[model samples]
Target: MTLRSGAVTALLTATLIASTAATAASTPAAPRGEGAGVLRVSTSTPLTTAARLQAAGFDLVESRIGTDLLVVGDAAVRSRLGRMGYRVTVQQTAPTTERPVSTGRTNGIAAAAATFYGGYLTADEYVQHLSDVAAAHPDLAVTRDVGDSWRKTQGLATGNDLVAICLTKLQPGDCQLTPTSTKPRFLLIGAVHARELSATELSNRFVDLLANGYGTDAEVTSLLDSTEVWVVPVGNPDGREIVEQGTTSPYLQRKNANNSLGACAVPPTSSNQHGVDLNRNFTWKWGGTGTSTNPCDQTFRGSSAGSEPETVALSQLMTTLYPDQRGPLATDAAPLTTPGYMLTLHSYANMHVIPWGDTTTKAPNDAGLRSAAFRASYYNGYQTGQPGQILYTVTGSTDDYLYGERGVAASTMEVGPNSGSCTGFTPAYSCQDGFWTANKPAMMYLAKAARAPYQLSLGPTTTSVTAPTTTVTAGTTFTLTATGNDNAYGTSGVGKPTAQTVNAGRYFVDTAPWNGGTAVAMTANDGSWNSTSEVAKATVPTAGLTAGKHQLWVQTRDSSGNWGPATSAFVTVG
Candidate 1:
């Protein structure tokens, strides 16, 4: 379902535009648990003759953009409508959600209630939590829906709708997006499974700490002011309700309450009773590898890519905010998200994962991703590496989708719900702070990601082809024209850089030269924007003709801001 598009014209006759202009034009299902490709489009094309376009089999993209939107419906119908001049983007239909299976020690049943009551923050509560904080500041707090989850059956058991929330710095346009760049977007999601109470607790505390510290903590204040942090405290409300029903027993159902296998696994003590693992249902691998079909296994592949409403809802939300890997949203926007990073909180594992969860192999950008993961790992005191490399080969993981399939920079910070084996639902509250403290570093790391997207693009890109005369006539300017690899508002790329300037990413000419006294040498710079590089040097003449023997030399630099090996040539006197 992954979609791609380009910047396009705006339409006054707008209905809905398809997600992408695939050769086959029609409304598509919400990418469901599949990778992010669905762009919802509605019927109606504007300006162009719909019939004329359709007969040619050309997808008449009537929306402002040429690409598609994640639409929900038959792709052919949507395309035909676009040809008829209806402005369409992807429409919402057939979305999905994932299931969870986290079997860990909780304090005995009697104490479980207190922990859930004190620690867990429901989606509604999350909103209230943020609102209360916003109420306190009013100036700093604002709410926005980055995207909506797939529509689903009313919680069959509790009959309640599911909810996800975003807690970030408010800005113009849609709350789902920031200005392509200028600020990094850090997403912190928790409670993908309802039973894991502490996951939500961590998020609740985060809101308070960040908002309250806008003035006290220098580091915290800087992050709140600059970074756009999205926090979804409770992702699966329906799944959580199931756990609530077993208040005393602490039932162990993993998947959302689809009841795919008999509707209920009363006193869920093993995978033989429950159905699929929601976390394993994402579209990236889409049953390609690491999926369970036994229905009773801990990880079950759904009917198709996105079978659950919960999975569908989250995918649509993520896709809209981030485009596909291929290219940009408009002539000016990034081709895709630069380094879209995310952190999904889980329990019972003292490990941090990178990518390629389906297999044991390493991903292409493992080093870079590892660098970012290390930032959080260092804080959590958790080990760093891939699932195969560290914990075991895990397939159908969200971290894999965020990094590989959907192009997000993501990692898993698995928190222990209980420190010891028997402590299950009733871990001591004293341990709460320790868990919170470990995750705080990772939270801070996420906040930093939102600060300017590492500004992969900064530079003194201006340079002048100059002579070594060491003197320029008065009023002479270099006529500098600056340019670099990364263009803002475009796809997220660290571009190319050297040790020039991490902030400005620039290169310049020496205002002063060797002036015949120093070691026959002149130095030039290469602006390594994001990484490191060497500097370049050229040779000067200690003795030459009477006074005017000029010389020509070539100097070069690399993306790492490294200078090139120098060579020289002779010039004749005037």
Candidate 2:
């Protein structure tokens, strides 16, 4: 959900109304109404009505297929929808106009949190945090200037650099801006729509999790050693600065600071604002459904495809980091060996949106995409589908461009629930930790799935690998246990995939099977692998092993012969 309109002053109120009506000709105007809030509108044709509302510049929140829409707007919006013959119900009113003051803790996580808002991070703070993380963990993280923001390119004083941080074990060619790399890449882009505060904060936490948990956490250690995780926090820094500058309330700025065309209001309101919607300014499926030609509208597609500097820079970065794996046809599917995965975070939409967002038509690799989305959504409990099937038809989104143009496996994760303290565009600061805890496992799953997304996503998952003790003496035998499940896919939304039986399981000591480690058979605890869930165990012989920490990698295979992603447990042979 992008914009929420409100009156700034008595004098400019009329002008704002006129501007909104003039720009949004498709939208009907009603008498001036008080109070701005969220609305749940019931409609028999949800998909059609969703697209209609989007085209009319309504702030349509993400909703499940065949369900009533959740919209954020004022009384006029309600009246207009009423005239259009829809039943609208107010969900909740906007918070008070008084901004919540921050305590301003200068050390640790509080420092990165927003000064005015307690949980969210400002654009400048996010950039500083990236630099601080890189400085504190040089061996595991490096920050790069991907491109310049719109204001920066315009030589404005308040501009910022489009920065990205890559986290991995720094090998010779690691983190370089090259398509060829020694390890697979998982790129997480956040806050492309600047008002989505939780997106940026989530990215920040992900960086912290991987960079700080390197050696101590077995999963994080194995992931960083085998994959390059990239984070582009605060993608629209200029607009984010405007959002940070909000005094009375947070500015719902959803676009870049390229106020070159329209006579938009100063200190942008929810409805009338100048700038291109960065998410809608991509080259693929540009200027289509769910986008507006009006510069004042929230979903304003730029003057041309990839017109915004931020959009161009992001596309260029993806091209540099990921090779084109699919053919030029719309029906062509990327191979199962595709090496990169991408997730763009948005707000107020509890959805894991797959590619081909502009239409309900499934992508060429819909099976793999849905499987991966379902697997990730298992942690977050989000609905998974194409944007048209889940929320509304969105064109020129980053996920669509990355998947359609560059052949990368990409999806958009709309964070936060529809209702609660953690809901809405600017959720309460206290909601950050809860959201992070809920999303961490899902993010980790997607990061690990980047290795072979199409193939690994189809197999059973090795949920856990455990030993009775992490430390053991030399020339000793220890039992290793693991839990494998083929039914780990999420069933919260449309297209619930069928689960397969876990037919086989194996464990490898000291090395991964791909690295020529010998596989040791693990017998099922229940004496058979006839069900979707299985518990397997094995005894490892450490007689010939050297005295040091060794990784025990465990993997499971489904009855269909698909090998899932590996889970590692460390055993110290001291």
Candidate 3:
């Protein structure tokens, strides 16, 4: 997400690091203890180099082929690599420092808006906050305990239960996983990487705004009435607790607390020995090019696809909310009929990346995904594209898993510090304003867009039908006319080529006795519609009718994959 400032300098640095590549070192047993200090290691390829570093038990700070890795390890790391013939350079000698926790938050409703900017909250505080809102507004907010985090499952005091909050006026099956109703859905997940604290804060604030603004805000009320906004504010509670432990200068823990993988040879011990990168643990493209086998490494794919508890739970939640809206393979684009959208927030990179992160291959629904991301970026000003196109290749990521495997329209929003005044991983509490202010509109757009995420918002109605009389003789031919507009017009992020045109319609006729009819495509020009409200006509042949009365039905499908509301015209045969 952070494009290195000096391209030439970065390339030279990366080359210097790669040149030191030596013979593959023998795999060492899990470190008996942690190592310290910082080292810069480089590889010819970003993805492969990262895999090497992680596999070697190095705690990576940041990495890319263009930007040599910044890692944490002691002199033994240097010695081992020296023996292996790989070049290693000392970047810094000091231990990583923590950011001091801010003491400004009150966690009270009166100051709810201020709480988001105050500081990051503890896992318990987050749970309490969700409960508080649900308690205060029973009709508008509700919380569900989805599952227990890894730490909780381990019987540790630091572990916490996973929770999801639904902010909509409740009705039958409103928040349940069952897809029984007609309402559209938007799912927002935050803090999957424990170090990205702002994600959680932003999610919490969104929950607060929606639950509190119910009747007071017209737009919010209408949105809730028609759509469901589900938020999982803390997606990785075990890892979050580790990061929270170092409140003074929050500990940097990128993965969960599943210590089955032993500690890295890096200091600040606890995080190194445990956890899988929940982001890389998803089933789709799991264990592909940009992941690791070393459990101690930051981007380690778990023992198997969907291996981690966090991964399993979140994936289950997503499936529970949305059916596989797209076809089973890569060529199958999500049906325009699908009505789900997902956004998972991360930080330190001011970018909104579309799916297909597993490789450079474009998704079948790439057009819709790119269009939505570009439109969403208008409000936040974040660069948008498939991750492999804009950023580096990342396998088994949440967005890719959601979109590729489940056929949901999904993206990852890297929340803060695009460039100027870069705050890096944990930006100060004061910097929250810049993020929230810029993202408000984009977030709201996502909520409204859920109504028809994959479809163009166009509906056609039958305007008129002409025939000889109400009792037209059998074998008589007549015409039916109807009009429709691209309802998406004038809406922000809408009306692009993808959302502005209607393509075809299925036109059908039923005889006087109302014989069960098989529908067929409308013939010729009748099948196509254009303009804001253009009239489309269908010529009907009553050759097979039994006389008496008959009915005509027309339903149009827009170019953007939406089926317009059905329109009907009645005619009689004598």
Q: Identify the superior model by lDDT, candidate 1 or candidate 2.
A: 2
Q: What is the lDDT of residue 352 in candidate 1?
A: 67
Query: What tens-digit string does per-residue lDDT give for candidate 3 at 150-256?
Result: 87777865567789988887887787767655577889999998878889889988898898887655446656766788999999987776665442345567788
- In each prediction, how many residue pairs overlap at the backbone (N, C-alpha, C within less than 3 A)? 114, 0, 11
Residue 351, candidate 2: Cα error in Å is: 0.8
Cα misplacement distance, residue 292 of candidate 3 (Å): 0.9
Candidates sorted on TM-score, descending:
2, 3, 1
lDDT of 1: 0.45
Q: Rank the candidates by lDDT, best first.
A: 2, 3, 1
Model 3: weakest 10-residue lDDT segment is 27-36
Candidate No. with top lDDT: 2
Question: How does residue 444 of candidate 3 score in lDDT?
Answer: 73
lDDT by residue (499-569, candidate 2, tens digit) is 99998999998777767888989989889989998998898888999988888889999999998888888
Every candidate's CA RMSD: 21.6, 4.9, 13.8
TM-score-wise, the better of 2 and 3 is 2
Candidate 3, residue 571: how far the Cα is off, in Å: 41
Which of 2 and 3 is the better model by lDDT?
2
Error of model 2, residue 127, in angstroms: 0.8
